[model samples]
Target: MHPTTTLLPLPAEAPPSLTQILDEVTTVLCHILPSSLSVKSFSTRWQVLRSKLATLKSSISEVSDSLHWSESPLLQTLLPNILSTLHRVQTLCDQCSDPTFNPGKLLMQSDLDMATGWLSNQIHDLDLLLRSGVLRQTNAIVLSQPVPGSGKEDLGFFIKDLFTRLQIGGIEFKKKAMESLLQLLSDDEKSANLVAKEGNVGYLVQLLDLNSHPSLREQAVSAVSILASASDQSRKFVFEEGGLGPLLRTIESGSTGLKEKAAMAVEAITTDPDNAWAISAYGGVPILIELCRSGSTTAQSRAVGAITNVSKVEDIRTALVEEGAIPVLVQLLNSGTASTQEKAANCISILASSGEFFRALITQQDKGLQRLLQLLHESSSSDTLEHVLRAIYSLSASESISRVLSSSTTFIIRISEIIKQGSIISQHISASLLSNLSISDGNKRAVSGCMGSLVKLMESAKPDGIQEVAANALVSMLAVRSSRKELVRDEKSVMRLIQMLDPKNELVSKKFPVAVVSAVMAGGSQGCRKRLVAAGAYGVLQRLTEMEVAGAKKALQRLSGNRLKSILSRTWRA
Candidate 1:
């Protein structure tokens, strides 16, 4: 970008005179360059060679411009040699831009990286020969590093002047100049950011907006993304350069690939609250949501993440959800690629979890249950299934959910496996869903065999694990008409269920009580209540009458609400 950004110094002494160095540069350009190399190839290698050509051009221009040839024998001889050298360098940059030659494979040459290093050393030797105070031609190669200044100046200060100097030279060298910057962007974010610190970010920003080469534009955007990720300091450095406006604009205008990178850029930019708030200030949500609606899978997924980041504020989150992101996300569950689905799923879950705000979708008011259920069945990955289930649970209201599960008694099998095998997060999902997971009439038939397993489990395990699971499975089993007799007749089965109701014993040991209470409150129409109450779960509820916990509170309310309602109804029947 600008040469003023770096503090690179001039070498006071080194081997090789100016002309000797020019001769070596000439040999490398004319002889070392591949016969098939194009101007673009040579141009991309501009960083390693531009300084020498700039110096040679400067010396020749001086001899022709003002230095009386008679004034210095060096200028007279230097003029002709410089002429030939500049001609070769020009021809090399031209060849690089040609299609007849390959730029890609050529840069990948076996010795090129080493050649670049060697070329750098020769240019260094030439810099040492030029006098510091003499106004040399603007012909020296631009070094993107800090070095000793011409007069102990800050390298960072000279950068803007260097860029302004290039501006005067016109963009004739733009093809090569931009290539150098792109390389700089990828090479080290710190160096790229330094160029930005000197205000070179404006150059990249301006370039992204121009109707330019697709690949080149992408490179420009990618460079900005790199700088933003470099350091916390650089992140703001880019933002202040007026970058987000153009970037968000580009996300709306570019192809899927462009949108993808732009979304990724948004991700890096939104890594913190202030940055995210900046994006929101820049109209981040609408752009991201539009991208989600129109872009490819990767684009949409990343856009979802970007939207989520910016939505960390409640207003922003509500804005997105109100803007109809919920339905769009539900559609995305089946859209895009696998990675896209995973991301969209997560984004939707985050929004669903923020508040009881998504009651419409969760309660089946928006008819989300069936759609979510299908995803849970169709998804192959354990995580994807977990997100779908949680989102469904988060979005739905409980009683409406009950109607949906009424037909699927066996629904808990898939979920039980999730607890046993999935991530800790998903295992928690299993715990959360266990209370609402209903036993289908078919699952009722299956609980008989597992009943024996459940009893054996309690006898040998940790108190919390055994009781929690026993409570959950007991609640589930009590729902089965097919498994009810054996379960109740194990006569001692009633006592085991009763014994688990100890409030003091339940907390450290059990997480399954919600289902246990739900089962007891609902499982017995006649004999079941006495069976469960005989088991002492009713007394346990009595003990918790004065307790508090979000879950325990809900459990107590449900336990009380259903028992009183059941007693009133039964009294009328009598």
Candidate 2:
């Protein structure tokens, strides 16, 4: 029925032997040995080769213990050579990736030919070793004892070995040990905690010193980054153990890779509020600012992160601004990658929080406002949107910035939309910006067009700060004749303002609504006055006139003129 119902057996598919995998990896590596290539193309090829080699290394490590090396003396003899070849390949990869090295000029055609010949010989040796029944070996010599389980004792012993190696091993051995420990700490939080508790931060700090090998120092910084990232205790240990000096030095002068790792570690340490001051004290702020300007993209990003964390403290923020970080940060905002832009924006937001002086400097010197507005229009990231909005809000406190922002129709409309649709933080910041911008007559007129949105914000069940700011914005809008009529004509807005005059409300809440009512009444618009009286404004004003609150007397006077003051005087006389 089915062509004699005979199912021919499928060809037996053989799994790749270890030698085959090694040969495949070596072939990939050999492809990168071509000279006379474009720098960009060479970089691409090099990255591919590096990835393949890393995969091969990981594969070997995963199976090394199970390999029966003694069963085939030939394979056993070649094992160390194979590992040495792999390490040399990795070293070459590292050299290529080094930021300082110009790969295009470093390797001539003759040099590449030599490298190719050497790699060919290594590949042939590996083939010979594999053919001598290397993959068939089963009897293994247990040269190293295995730690049976991942118990506390096992972890302790493992950490002790790492510490011993870090303390006394030669440069290469120290680098490997540190890299292994860093990987272990990153992979296992328990190990990081144990390392931190055991006071190993001092050794890590020592490895970062200037006298150490650059590669070893880089590994030490990475280890510190992992440890600091794991927990607050580790962060404190790193900070207290005098790690900041070496870390900052590395950021200032180490290789590009080292700078990135050191910046990251600094960021981790600065997350604790207490250590932030220490960084500033160590002259780290200016160095971080410099990195943001000249370091690689990754280092710039990490530097921005560290600056953001450190800028959380008021004193440090002032110090950062004085170090001319504002303009540099603005530059990064305009040209850096998306992550860098967000971090720079966030750092500027914190710096802007320090005072109006920094705000003016940021908005005036660097075209910061223009850049922020552009990012706001282009970015879909909520974090970027939030930070940029906050920075704008703070910078708008400057009178000049307020006028400038109000002059831009697109800026004003976008702010209105953000208030309507953004996250809670964004909405609040937008409302505050509106309030700040509305201080100028031009801003008052511009913001007045969005009266309905501001009215809705004032009517919302938001926090006291947001509602207060929204009310203040409406007050500014009502002070403008064109916006006054629209606000008065909106019966819902009139009712919301009347509701805010409650005596039981917080003093801050009552202030803005009273001022808004007073502005509308003082405008002498018959329609607005009618609406206010119709919305039970007289009773609210009458009650406020009885309280000893600030602005109550002025509000009553504006609402009812001299009659309210006379009535109040009569009530006191009674």
Candidate 3:
């Protein structure tokens, strides 16, 4: 015998490599292997081997950098999907490979946490797209619902198999598969296009009609955002699909979580002027007004954003103002919380910029001015104050309205005190409010008594402070033609202004430098211009000319031309 061990025959099923371990079996298997198997058996085994080889090759191809088909559209489209599929597949494989990733436990626990995090983010982005979703075909609300008997579905069986493999394979394998799926959906354009082609958008809309789950609502909203935002066509679909109605209802539905998103839908709807009209046609105005009136603070904020979007149109703005948004906002500025105060103040400020708003709102100056002053004095929040000052600036900017409030010495003194005590931002705003006060002759006299302090305030306050006060004061002072003007007789007054115009020794503390420079240029006559020029005004003017591109350049150009030569001629020769 070739070996001491005896065997009847080597089994056909034994692996070839195992034969070497058996001294006698190796020779016996070699001799018997060819005759033991029939042709049919050999063919069947070969087919199985071929199939296994193909699967191995497919898996290997997924990991290869060469498979990164950046050139072909088909590859580009399929690559992300293929990769995501493989990622999800591998993650599942790895989970089953380890016992720690048990389905019986919480899904968020252990390695499942990673997958849930990924899925949650995906769900979040998808939710953003839903309410905003504009399908290439048509727009519809989307809701997702889980179907029954999914347990017995073929996909479920494959999934079960994959999980089993994951338990044996490890978490790393499962993670790899999940990564591939995420990569595909991450690119918005590609994903949206694919979604359009597959009628996923339509299906989602159908889901929206039937489903009420918070998770489904969130996902649906995401898709809508993507579509409405993506194109005009998509937005049109969203409006046609009755999206706004549901969103408005959601705003009032008392779901704090959904309120913000509902408002976002309104914002997207009003992004285009035509859409604004469509929204108005759809009765968005009263809904938004009510949202502003009675919705939660968050809801109100969102409602305001929605209003702002539509307010770009003149009709929408007029509707809002007519609905008493202006007075309500003015009222809220005083009575609302800090956040509400700020929001109301900002909206009024925006409204005040419109000629219509000013005509409608500021016409009642004394009544409004009193409320604004109260806000200025009472609120401690810096944000509220800044915006309150801006709103005042916008409203009282008109000479007529300002004349009404200018009669109040109390208002004048309070404003003056604020200029002195407030921070730089406050100083800038205080200075602006002063511009409005100067519009009235009576108020000018009251402020002129503090002209000494005004001069000092000008010296220390910031450039923003200087801009409005100096510019407006110069115009108003020159416009007065008053020999009896309260400020004109103060000899040190002109002198103080001249010192501020000096450029060489820049007192960076000047609150409104740009405005101050402008005021000097505007009000200073040939002689006064000469004085400011001599006090090193040119250097600062030139520096500002170079530094700023807007109104600052216009001021510099005016000073450099006729004003400079004329002033020198008047001051030097005389």
Candidate 4:
């Protein structure tokens, strides 16, 4: 049998003598105090001392209550003094553990000397009383057994002992051992690392198995949650030890508290990509979706967070959508907290990225587009807006959705405003959305009203992709007769299009500009043609005609009869 599982024999039913009790108290105090000289050890030393003191106080009370006080006056008198000394020592330990206490300054040699001297006086008085036969001697109370080993070695032994008890001990013993291990894992990252490195993580994982006691399984779930949350390395260790299978099982069938903690553990573990696939294989996606839909607030948040992480991969994202994650995430977006709303938006973004089928699924949900637009309007966070815009961009890929969004004056204005003022990514997405919306004639005219902003975006020194999208939006708008007239009326707009005809520009950069010029010349309005010519369109087109670029040849062919062209031809010949 494991030593930790071996319950020590209980003491006989007799009141202890004063001398024996004092000796027992002294031994407890000795273990509580630090033997090392470093002041850094003070906090740990105080914690151990405080725990031992509680057990000693309980034992002393038990012995005192059993005595016949009137028949033992000396014992009674000395008991009060001894108890008083214990109380003082307990108070001192409490102060040392207080957050505000600076160990570096408070743990001076002089302070230690004073405290030890006082304790010695109390012990000496108790001994003198014993010699005078004023207090009877009884068997010493063995309050508790001291853990074997010291310092770092002690932590290793303590973990091994707990594991042994967990394996072979009774229900009550297992509970106590599990609780002890849980407390150590909860203390800090260092403690959790110690537990993981000691090969106890696998044992803890075993406790979570189906065959383990329900209560032990619950405690084990809670411990795994702590270890997984304490550090990334510890979380990886739990996953490697096969934590995901039991954790998902608990989420599916455990009690409410266990389910909540198990969900949290699964969430932490799923941060690793391999574990995410394992969770999905264990059929965790459907369970997570249910948790998001109906679990407690904490469970719902963690469930959604896990789904968000899991949905990052393509195959899993398709599975999540098929399980109807889109509508549930849309519901969460409308009613959940800001954080939940953000995560839901991210999941939706990923799902929507899968393809047009998933995009249509999200768009077809009741108030799905409305909720996403509302979130876009209400959110001040850049990340949330970025995801919302990405989803919008995907949804806009469907011409039906694009036409719906394009027809809404409010939606068009909001997207145009984002292009004008949002973050760089937001600007890029908004531009892409506008480009998609511009595919429809009515949407073209609607976006054409914001021509100045589009022009500025194209002119800014952002990446070619952003500028290309903006240019495409402008070119699409130019296809509408009214928008074409608007472009020709603004000389700077006309001049910008003319400048884009520069031969050195990339083929992509030149495509829209060529299309815009061709559209204007095709309008055949003499006044618009004269405005383009005045905006230096003649020189740009003459050069393009020489190079025989696609749309430039067609545009130059149409300008053949201009009397103004003759004057420009003489200047070009020079």
Candidate 5:
């Protein structure tokens, strides 16, 4: 007859004392006699089981020293499973030692294999908890004052508990923890700083792995986005922790919602210009371009924004072009939403500013000029128009594109209209665009109608660059006799130009104003010369000439010669 044996009860719902349970398991494993078993296979299995228990004990001991291990929420939550598995090992060893309860070699070997596997898993879970550094963080954290209306709950302890839950639990537990953490981050910037300061950004970055659940990746990316957007320090933490690659991967392969969040995170991180090359290094340009090409509207919007930031790097801008971003970006100029089109326009503008080669890529290969002009006419949003005009301004530097723009009476007239009536920014960029257009002789006549608007902008002269650009445009258009006639005919235009030449008017550049005065003196009607002297031009010109301003001496010579001739002709008539 077999001796009756008592089995250990299942672990209770609540965690048991960690030190007591670990020591008890250690003693039980140490006292086991694998060599006493009759079957060699059973003895071998027992030996393996003992080896796994030793490893588990070593890992526990290594981590237990870092914190109040018995009270650690992570270790405490792990206790029930740890005890369950250890008790199973004990029961199996007891059965192996029992003479009357042999279940045969195969069943015993299978049972031993299952126990070993379970013990290995428990060890893995423990290692994951230890590696999380949550225990050390918890031990060192100083508890803050209770959050208002939370009934004196220790906010620091609660946050650490959430971190523990994230690291040491099943998918559902981690999901809840992620949800709660995200909720906390969303509440305020302070919470985001606290979470990021704990050095757990890598945990969130891990969730961005392609194998993770979609919803989990989405949550992780959303949390990362918040942290990156919170401040420059958190963004540095995200980059240092290797978050960019996974984020780019998510943009490449995640669902629409997930891609938007990931794109947003990428955008925020890349806002630090130093981080821009990492996107290119990770081959994110193609992914972002593809997203701009085919993602959902919101996804496309975010992808375009990220590209805008990433493209700030010179090499990434070339990579973007090499990835065929030009066509895709041009196509986005017609996107149904204003925000998407606006971002696409901003990105295209940036690309166009790179060099003439990129401008050709946007204008020649993709008809970007036409699309921007079309957007110019169709869009009512001032912000969208501002970017679109800026893009057109960028493309206007190309001669072929300039001809196309100058020939379009609608485009020229639109530039005129924007200068006259658009927002201050739109008007500024439009003035610059007109200045660029006026560079080509053929476009000079086309842009001559904008002379009044240009003169008005120069008269405002609040933002000095716009006034300078308008003055340069008038200088170019003065090559056309009629543009010269138009400028000198407007007394306000003549007065503004002379006023800009004053050394006291230091806000506007003297170079363009000097050029304008020289052009007007060289080409204007003699009556216009009289108006220059009348608008306080002689004093400003003499002072500028003394200062050795370029073109100032020639303008002074012309003004002096004209005045001397006028006096001689008057004296001869007398």
Candidate 6:
């Protein structure tokens, strides 16, 4: 009996090794090339198919050496399908090589086209496997084994493993991987550094593709948002990978939650000016404007923040203004939550600072000034108040806005209260604004009511700049005779102006104080000039005159002439 030739089936529990599968694939390709070459009519089609198979084979060989082929989840998932495709090619090749096989030409052509497409897909799969950083598994393995006495577990392995899933896993797997990755990034900035170091930020950017599932894109954007917000290095990498274009698309088309995360990412990445301009070039301003106009509060806040950052670029600020962002921002100032209102206020301030055109736009917006003033009354956060004050201050720089502001007596009184009671920074801005407003001849009387507040601010403000601003504002107000008379009537206010002229009193500008005193002397009664001279104005003006401070020489001459006249009058009376 021929040694009993009963063939035993291989164990179902054990799959073929990677090396065995690769060998089988190579053998099948070798058979396909010779067999395909023999079919004369379809030789060109066969050549194309064979070339694709050969490329797939080469990709597999290249990655197999660097990757631990046995342990690779990529190969484990892809190899079975890859091997099944090779078998189909092998059967197709055999049919083409068979002399007796007579499948119609159309059938043969279809078979060849199908085989070529299959090989192309397999090649792409292999490409993804190699790009997935499967070779980095060596680092993961070494990192997985704990070092002696190192209490902290290294997450190198976990991060790399997640990247592999993002790069090569199916949609469900990628979604899960992104969720875990975001959680990891949210929990520790170290993971973001690792992800950046691993050069896998592009993987997250890839998931932002418009063709990606909405849930996956949202998760991916969330991950990117965390990474960008956490590290500048990762943010640079994200921008390099063209993250802004996709992020803008997400803002325009994605769901509210996705748009919010994308806007946050855009805001964080755009901290760099290059990224800011890049966003504008990609037409991000209008999308962000629309989001601020219609998105949820969180989305509106983030979009406004992004606009704020982008508008730091001069041209981009022009673009934002042209896109009608000012009115939308003004609308938010009235309707958004406090945080949103603050963001809107800040963006408007930035726009206002950019140019006179933006300031005019802000002023021209419906109820823009009204909404900002309302915020000052309603917002309890110092940050919000600061931003609103800054926006108003910026608007106040425009002559038209200044005239409008000066016309409102209620506005003038409220500003006086703010100068007295607001934060020091708010006080400083308010004082500066008051100075600007006082320049308008028509505004002088309306703003003159704030003179007491300005005098108190000059004496009590901490920063020298604030005091200087108040003194300067007092000088502007003094341009009106009514303001000078009020100052002379309040002897203490005249005394404060005298104190400011002292060279030793360095907190206020000498020119401003000199101007204030000159106006007060010129407008006051002779008794008022006598009181000023008694209050030490003569010595302060004399020193300032020697120091060559502007307006000082004339001021001292004025005071001396007044004193000489007063002495002559006394003699004449005696």
Q: Whole-model Cα lDDT per candidate?
A: 0.57, 0.71, 0.52, 0.71, 0.76, 0.77
What clash pairs does model 4 have?
17-138
RMSD of every candidate to native, in Å, equals 17.8, 17.7, 18.6, 18.8, 6.9, 6.0
lDDT of 4 by residue, 1-574 (tens): 7566767899889876665665666564564444322224455544444444444445444444543322433344555565556656655555554667665655543454455555555444433333222122231111122243335655655565566455544577678878888777665457777778864688789888888887888889999999887788889899999888888888888877988899888888888787788767888899999999888878888899899989876678878877888889999987987778888998888888778888888988999999999999898888889889988877777888877887787787787778777887888788788777645676566657567667666755666587778777766666778887887787666667776777765534555666667766665667777787777777777888788777777776665546567789999999
lDDT of 5 by residue, 323-423 (tens): 88888888888864788888888888888888988887776655667788899999988988988887777777777777777667677777777877888
Using lDDT as the measure, name the better of candidate 3 and candidate 5: 5
What TM-scores do the predictions have? Answer: 0.52, 0.60, 0.44, 0.57, 0.75, 0.78
Error of 2 at 416 (Å): 3.2
Which 10 consecutive residues of model 6 have the lowest summed lDDT?
141-150
Checking candidate 2 for backbone clashes, the offending pairs are none
What candidate 4 gets wrong by more than 4 Å, as runs, is 1-195, 209-219, 229-232, 255-257, 312-322, 439-464, 478-574
Give the per-residue lDDT digits (tens) of candidate 3, residues 1-574.
5768776886679532211322232233233233223223224433433343234334323323222222222222223433353355344444544556557544424434454344343333223222121211121211111133333332222222222222222334334322321232334333333333333344334324434445555555556556555566656676666676666666666356666666766777777766677657766777777777777776676676677666667777778766766665666666666766776666666677777545556446346766777887787777767777777677676776576556666766666666656656766666666665644565554455444445555665455446456445444434433312334345565556555544453663333444544554564455545555565556666765676534557656655666667789999999
lDDT of 4 at 299: 84
Instruction: Report model 3's TM-score to 2 decimal places.
Output: 0.44
The model with the greater TM-score, 1 or 5, is 5
Error of 3 at 276 (Å): 5.4
- The number of the candidate with the highest TM-score is 6
How do the residues 339-431 of candidate 6 rate in per-residue lDDT, one tens digit apiece?
Answer: 888988988888887778778778777888899888888888889888998888888888877777777766766676677778888878878
Report the Cα lDDT for candidate 2: 0.71
Ranking by lDDT: 6, 5, 4, 2, 1, 3
Clashes of each: 46, 0, 65, 1, 0, 0
The per-residue C-alpha lDDT of model 2 at residue 552 equals 74
Instruction: Judge candidate 1 at residue 571 and give its lDDT.
Output: 98
